[model samples]
Target: MPYRHLFKALQWGLILFCLCFAMVGGTMAERLLELLQCQPHANPALRSCAWLPNALGLRLAPFLSAGGISDYPFVLLQNFWALIAVWMVALIATHRAARNAASTAALPDRGKTRYPGITGADAGRWASRAAFWVLLLGLAGFCMAFGTPILGNRVALEVLGALGCSPGTFDPFSSPCMSAPGFWTHRLAVYVIPLAGPLLAPVWLFMAFWDILLAWTLLTAAAYILQDHLSKRARRPAP
Candidate 1:
């Protein structure tokens, strides 16, 4: 029982970690863009030179950023890829832990009441719930990372305007006058492409659905492991 509780704690902790990790990366990318924009003194040639903020972004920069003023797609894709990697790692680890716990639970007991913990049916149920929760959580995480900074920047723009910072042409790291609307428009590409565009050629749907399935699989494994441990503890000799 003690270990079972620990397993649950770990599962929750990992999910939180993944969420935070994703948010952090998103924040970094957003900040980098802001930083680039603020550097008005940069060389003329370097003005338009914007690097991908994340690894995946860097990898797909050439293909995605083609003819685009802003490479928002790369940034979003990086965050998406990072989230998936983290989630997959956590799921695999949890699955292994669950398997071990289940095996331990099957050991012969001297004499005690044995109660079933996680069963095959339980796994299916738990997975469904986990998938739902993960989907919501993932959305929140992604938004916090990718959207919050933009919102903050919007506020900053308003405050600057109030303080007398005049808006100028939206230039890449050149003119101090940055167009928030333009920024948003450029960033919107990241969302539009996957949600509605023809980039994935229908593969996007599968990627979107993968989250739910992945979450279910991971949580089910964790639940089964913890339940098995609890079941084993239930049959132990009581003093």
Candidate 2:
């Protein structure tokens, strides 16, 4: 089988996935950071940036609500779907391309050419494919991990109610103001959670990287099993 089309499809799939992730995920992350930075400030000028209270609130609502952290998983799911979609499309395109190339080939080209295992060209091709898949998979995993909690409840309160240093309630000088060490600790949590969430995601990626390896191993194992079975059958006495 001509692997060139398959290779091309994977290439395009990676590009499409990255573009979509950057456009959607990147935009959300930026706005989140902006909201976090500006919403906490006491200055009326910074707070009155038109996209205040309600606007920013709506953007952050998913992550700010009690279980807002779930939104990250939801977003990560979205990224996965995007990659899946691209991969499927690429598969179809690769099949069509292979068919077309086959149809145009010389009739005598029906015979298969055997290669001495893992030639330089073959190794290079495998390396390129591995690299691209790794890059895309890594980013998607990171999005699911880091992206989920970066703008979660703790972070939300910090950004939305940082001045109050209170939990549950946003009104700082209201009847139930938070002045105790508990309030301060909660405030510290709010600050630290958002800051650490993003950083931790990437760091955790190192651990999660095993997921990619496992997937590759399973796929390759399946291929090897099929190949071994076929090889054994070929060597069998007339069956």
Candidate 3:
């Protein structure tokens, strides 16, 4: 039973890890392009900006509603989906663990318990920790990629310069204009101000940074929440 539960937990960990890297991988390229001020893929519909409210129940959007500590848009939906993926993985893992426990308990002798055919848990576990570590490394890679001057592309800054992009060209989570997030320099008490100041955009990349941070923060937080929820579920009395 211990082994089975551990396997199930690790399974969920693997799935969540995969999801973490997937978000960083899928959104990096295009969002980076937008951050670099490159014209999008021909009228895609994104319009180079997106939005969502902050934790304070205040509405916010890229380049529109600004000056709040958490105000920004969710420029990338793929990251949002990755967060959802984590929840699904956890649900499956817990259910499987529960089922396994029930089945094992039902047997008279229970000499050696084994699931004949795993409905969804058929996917056996081998080395989940190794995979999880790899995913963390990949996320670091994407975070680096999100930075200005794409690795090995010595001319990246020059290219941005030639294209008239901001000198502050940064990653999806950073302001392309190098502008600081509203809360960074403010005191804890001052950060509560809504529409505290005017938002100016010499370039669109500035807005992109806001959107990226907003989405990634929400997604990562959701991932954390799912992990906690699943961990608690596995401890509950079986129904």
Local distance difference test values of all predictions, in order: 0.45, 0.47, 0.37
* Superposition-based RMSD of candidate 2 using all C-alpha atoms, in angstroms: 15.0
Residue 189 lDDT, candidate 3, scale 0-100: 15
Q: lDDT winner among the candidates?
A: 2
Whose TM-score is greatest here? 1
- Please give the distance, in angstroms, between residue 68's alpha carbon in candidate 1 and its true position after superposition: 30
Against the true structure, what is every candidate's RMSD? 15.9, 15.0, 16.8
- Encode model 2's per-residue lDDT on 1-239: one tens digit a residue: 46565767577877665554434644554566565664433333233433344344333334333233434556545435555676776676677767755655533434323212335654455455555555556556544543454533334344445343343334333323333333233333322333453455444334434565477656655555555555565457764
**lDDT (Cα, tens digit) per residue for candidate 1, span 1-239:** 45456557767875664454334544454455455453222222233333222222332323333333344444445435665576566666666767767776776773223545567756655565565556556655543433443443443343333222333433332333333333333332222332233233233333433564476557656666655665566567788
> Considering TM-score, which of the candidate structures 1 and 3 is the better prediction for this target?
1
Using TM-score as the yardstick, the better of models 1 and 2 is 1
Reference-based TM-score of each model: 0.30, 0.25, 0.26
- Model 1 ranges off by over 4 Å: 1-57, 60-96, 99-103, 106-118, 150-239
Ranking by lDDT: 2, 1, 3
Q: How much is 236 displaced in model 1, in angstroms?
A: 24
lDDT of model number 1? 0.45
- In terms of lDDT, the poorest run of 10 residues in model 3 is 51-60
